[model samples]
Target: MNAEVRVNAVFSDHMVLQREATIPVWGTGLDGMVVKLQFHGKQTEAVVANGCWRADLPAEKAGGPYELIIEAGNQLIVFRDVLIGDVWLAGGQSNMQWSLAQTDHAQAEIVDSHIPDFRFYDVPRVSYEDGIVHSPSWKVCTPEHAGAFSAVAYYFAKGIITELGIPIGIIGCNWGGTSIACWVSEQVLTHDDDLRIYADEYNEQIENFDWDVFAAKEAHYKEQIAEYDRRFAAGLREKELGDFPAAPMNPHYFLRPFGLYSTMLLTVVPFALKGVLFYQGESDAHRPLIYDKLLTAMISHWRTIWHHSMLPFLFVQLPAFGNGGNANGKEWPLLRESQLIVTEQVPYTGMVVALDCGDLEDIHPTNKKPVGERLALLALERVYEQPVESSGPVYKDYLIDHNKIILHFDHTGNGLEARGNQLIGFEIADETNEYVSAQAVIEGATVEVWSDQIVNPLAVRYGWANYTEANLVNSFGLPAGPFRTKREERQ
Candidate 1:
């Protein structure tokens, strides 16, 4: 005798399956039992093996309010009101996980969030050593649900719905303030010198830390969260709530090495995804020098796991905060530079520059609408082949004539224009590596930079300072991302 048929929690009522992709439906049941699936007037069947069974539903068209029926060993499971359409996974840190209720215009947005074509599914934060755990099911977008959903994810889905006129499903699998190393396997972390420090810390914690103490704290945290949810449902203001639970400095599920990837992302591997939208890297800002390698590795690892070599990946560049200077004085700018490097080097990737949408004093900017819309633009122009202005001016190449450096750019929507009286954040440097403020002007889609102090400029940098409020942008009003050309590039 074996256990009765049980489906993976990922598949349930009100779920939206990916359109134009092989739909994998898997579950556990009695070994060798006959399993059958019936959906959308087509039936596919497979035999249970090793205590598990699977069926592949054919690629479907966009519209669906269909029912999915499964039968195995006298046990039957049915999912109703299911949809078929585009599915995207939302990954990264607090910004990606920030809820709509905490964002700007929350009240008005919630009132108008009646779109039935958009849906969201959140994978609860849980860790397992060996097996998979089911948490929550798919939720349709209503005012109540939309209020608590990820603001960035919600806006991204909304943009897609408006443009494509198809059902959109967003799987929110993110944790706030989580480091990149936590989202990757320990083995992968160990391979890179930049990431091994986190792995070593986790190993030390496992040897010395008290598991019982951690368990007690975790239990208390969950209780507090439950109480907070209750208070929030009763119309309590967020500011009125005291403080959310924070894990101790020692070992915790979200902080431990490979914790999130093993728990949150492993079970969802190989599930069909149209693309991925990531917003993280703030926690890894301390080690800015290694961020580029770490993120590149993470992307490669995920693409391999998904079996999609060229999956369309788009990410939000960290917005400005705290005058763009960390206490260490090097973290923020370096991290932003590393983000730009990935966007330029990665084959199927894009980065949304939030240069003009940052908050000077707040780490978590409440203006997430532009972040989401920018991400959607990347998908629209690059993934869907839509002819749209997806970005602002990007440095293409430069020409030097005696004392002047002329900069050429791509994606100069309409033409270039300085947001202020004159272009700020421009610097000219000579062979000595000393830089001075340069006079800059927009000439159509090109910028001419020069400084009287430096007669022969050897390099040029824009928005290279810690607290730069650059005024250079294009006609579409998207600001140019920060960049600095090295001495080698000047040749």
Candidate 2:
């Protein structure tokens, strides 16, 4: 007899299925065998073709502690404690991967994190297609396992479950220090002119890839990493620890463009999802000019693969960071502009403003509770159709009235207000294209910006730097993100 039928590893005990959506149960099985799936008083079947089969169960309402049974050729697989609810995929870089145990107030959060309905599934961090890896399983929210869950995802789910009282499943699909290029498909990257550069660079890097050479380098890298870990555990300061080890850029390298798309993302495709929560872009900030187009293409490609034309994609706007060096550089500001552009142009998408939640010196800020809760607010307002103020004041348009510029804004819940006594981070530029600090005052629903030095102010910008102390916010306490009226010539 051929091998027994197997359901995808994503389907396991304590798993939460997307409620009110067709739940696709898929796996590999013997060729020409019949596979059947039964759940919630519904039955579906598909014949195995090319060693694969899929049976989609009918949608159900948001309540379940049911069992899922699959049978193929006398082989039976049963998964218990399955819940029907909204499922979300959390995708991004280090901030999204930062575990709950490493976040602020972790001990208290973990102690209170015993919501049985909320669950998490961490996709294994596989870099290469042929790399042997263990299958990941779902974990119920408990003090023991919640500590290891993504802090951002945890808080987001907690907020949702608190309000809606429904099971919320989060599929953690993220890696630290990875560019958006690593998560998108090769076909999509190669098809675009600007994006082709990533593919070209990747091809060049792996053209002479050698397993033997890679093995030797990896051994050395591991040793160095071990020593670094020892020193870090020994309480050495980060600056005193010296440079961290860099892995060899071989074919199996994790940072290789399109590598995670094949190894990590593909493994979770077609899985039912309410939407995607993205928090990346730090690695791609150096090339801010192309980030908007790159992110738009990535969202479209992901939606296509999941077969959801208007799949909701809510992403975090890159937060304030000084990069441990220059805090005034325009690269980060430009990247934030690109992110805002994507939200403006793309439909069924939202962005969470984290300007106030960022750290001035640390790239990885410890205050993730606000970031995750803000994301939950967006999902509630945009996706779940809840009555919530999800965003702060966003710049709408501007008018030049002689020496002063009148700026309008939207989403100013109630009205916009400077968090402190006075507004800061506002600058005006004359025809000379030189920006100087300007005085801004909230005027009813709009803000008036002016500088005595510039009689003919041609442009205005707010919080236009890699790191800023912008105090503008709405009555709800959400901060307005950085913005500029026009593209700077130097940028």
Per-model TM-score versus the true fold: 0.88, 0.94
lDDT of each: 0.83, 0.91
Expressed as tens digits, the lDDT of each residue in 97-198 for candidate 2 is 999999999999999889999999999999886746477899999999999999999999999999899999999999998999999989989999988999
Model 1 over residues 174-220: C-alpha lDDT tens digits? 98888888788777889877678888877876776787887887788
Candidate 2 lowest-lDDT run of ten? 235-244
Please give the TM-score that candidate 2 achieves against the real structure.
0.94
Off by over 4 Å in 2: 1-3, 131-133, 212-246, 489-491
Which one is best on TM-score?
2
What is the lDDT, from 0 to 100, of the residue 133 in candidate 2? 46
Angstrom error of the Cα, residue 334, model 2: value is: 0.8
